[model samples]
Target chain A: MRRHILTYLLFAVVTFVTWSQDTTAVSTGRHITPVRPSTNVVKQPGRDVSPELIEQYISGDTLAAERKAREDSIRRSYPRYPMMTSLWLGVNFIDPILMAMGQDYASVDVHATLNMWNRVQPTVEVGMGWGKTTPEGMNFTYRAKPSPYVKLGANYNFLFKSTPDHQAFVGLRAGFSTFKYDVDAHYSNSYWQEQTDFTLRGEGSHAWWGEVVAGLKVKIARQWSLGWTARWHHLFSCKDSEHSQAWYIPGYGPRGRALAFTVSAYYTLPLSLDRWPRKDSNYSAIR
Target chain B: MPLAWFYGSGTTKQVTVGNVTVYAIGAPGDTVLVNNQSVNELSLPLRVSTDRTQWCLTFMTTDSLFVTDTLTLAYRPIEYFASVECGAMYVFDLQQVTSTHNVIDSVLVTQPHVTNVEQVNLRIYVPTAQQ
Candidate 1:
């Protein structure tokens, strides 16, 4: 089906270019283009031969295919994405929504990425998070005020050669945060013959972690886009607290948990729009 | 967990605390966990309410010296989920340990995190009679 479509496309382009003087609409089926009276027609000697046959063609689009082939050819010869492309500022919605829904822990983060050649994106994220709750069926009340965290990473887009309307990327990030919280605990020590109740205030802790991310982003408007990323994070190291371990590390989520997720919307800022290779370039389109 | 006591000055042979009464400092109305018993090893309950625990070891020496020594432990009380049936509990992560060098010379926290595993969490060192 595709081959037939391409054949029709080639036919239409040939006919259109050859008969610019004719004012007839191009149709799908094979129809001889009418002679404009200025062109010469020759007949073959064979009995069953077509006399000056004019072919016609039609299809969805070979424009993209031809452009891709040309781009691929040029990429094979010249450098790909040789210039700085754009910068994207992203806002996360999943965490904020979950936080509003009374989740135990959540964050609001904004990130920025430098889209280099639509191939690699180096990014940085900064956010403030809070965790305030006593888990159901637990006796202690844990509280942490809004704490700040930062993450630095880069993403490699799998569809680098394709249009920049969407991306499928896998990336890595190094995250860090330092914060303080208070845990109010009330536990009965039967052996000690007492009911203990007190609060440990100003408990400080710092943590470092790494995340492996895989996500997809699609442009919705000219400058607006939405994306979702699933992240697998591991606590690399945390400053051990003698009173208690960190229940939550702002951006990284729960202390011992490994999996996390986020949905984000991006506002793109074009640093420099990439112009495709022009006809004057070394790998210009062939006639 | 039971913290094993040892004679720390040099002898490899383990020693026992003769006629020692052990009680938490914050216990109400003279409540004694160990009442004048020969103690080689004992399990001490840490308070979940606070980060510091102090225990008074009243040693009845052979010469009738009723010497008193203090054992202080500083730790982080971590909330732990033991099991569904047992519910949540507290575990101690030992941070700092010290003892007045009267009869008790020093304190050694062997395995810091106090959990359900029945291992030595601390080694309370005392001078030998030969010293």
Candidate 2:
């Protein structure tokens, strides 16, 4: 697994480097200012207005009107904000570094994602996921209980810029994962050992997690886009609670720490009230 | 049907030790028979069954085994087995017995695709008198 991951990273770096060499400037930097035309101060006979002055005045008025029209056209061409919702079929695998601590479980993660981005493209997302675990497989210790987890998180897109048809994003996420489960205590005492008793109970705990991601969204058809995201994640959970001392929830394992590498693919659809509009040439002539 | 079950699948075929008949069904591939006549065998990689409808067992004999075939054994409601894994057979040591739960010895056995694995929840029938 480690070798496979390293190979993929190397391949990605090579591809990114190769793609960056193109100087097409599909990128934006600081705002570019519009150049102003030179003004002519000349007077005309009878009307007290010079032809040059009238032409200049008309041009100035036209330019101001065109600027306003352009702004309005851009607004009409693209929605001020886009609401997006996505669903993904994901496979998640958790490998245990500490064999004595717990075993690992891999499952198909079903997720529903909701995102809203403002004009500057500030995006926020929340996902709901559910998966299954191996009951008595590997190094798992059963407290004879069911464990469930809920994940809540927020992401900030530092830079978001792309054509109306496609979107590219780089973002960072901070979130919390909470689980409820139970763990059985092993005893050496004969009375306890002889009974082989295991208690079924509920436990609750949370972990603070962060991830950095870069992704691309490509429009496939009307109202639909396919997106792929690669993320590196780090999570830290309390190993033992000060109030209730326990290694960790049964299914989740000891809280000490855990890390996961994940990649996701999603199908997204626009949920905004207004859709992308075509640019109008008339708006340019007005100015 | 009277259902008889074993823990997992693919254990070495157990042979009779002297006149003592060790006719038992625990793992898949365990051969069973009546006297020297072969009866039935099972499929590989057993899975847990919650519904009594899914539990099945067949038998085969060693000698007089003119025909070899498999048949589903009846489920003995008096007996219950869960569809949960118990690791390999070797590593598990009988821990204890509770009012509702029982701990038995586990053994680590290798299968075709898997490495050393443990069997979980091997059933042990404690007589009423013993209990």
On DockQ, the candidate that comes out on top is 1
Scored by TM-score, the top model is 1
- Supply candidate 1's per-residue lDDT for B122: 74
Listing every candidate in turn, what is its Cα RMSD in Å to the true structure after a full C-alpha superposition?
20.3, 29.2
- Model 1 stretches with alpha carbons more than 4 Å out: A1-79, A277-287, B1-42, B46-118, B122-131
Q: Ten consecutive residues with minimal summed lDDT in candidate 2 chain B? A: B74-83
Those runs of model 2 whose alpha carbons end farther than 4 Å from true positions after fitting are A1-103, A106-161, A184-203, A219-226, A232-267, A271-275, A279-287, B1-131
User: Residues B7-99, candidate 2, lDDT per residue (tens digit)?
Assistant: 322333322211111222343344332344322222222222211112222222234222222221222111111112432111112222122
Give the winner by lDDT.
1
lDDT accuracy of residue B58 in candidate 2: 21
What is the fnat score of candidate 2? 0.05
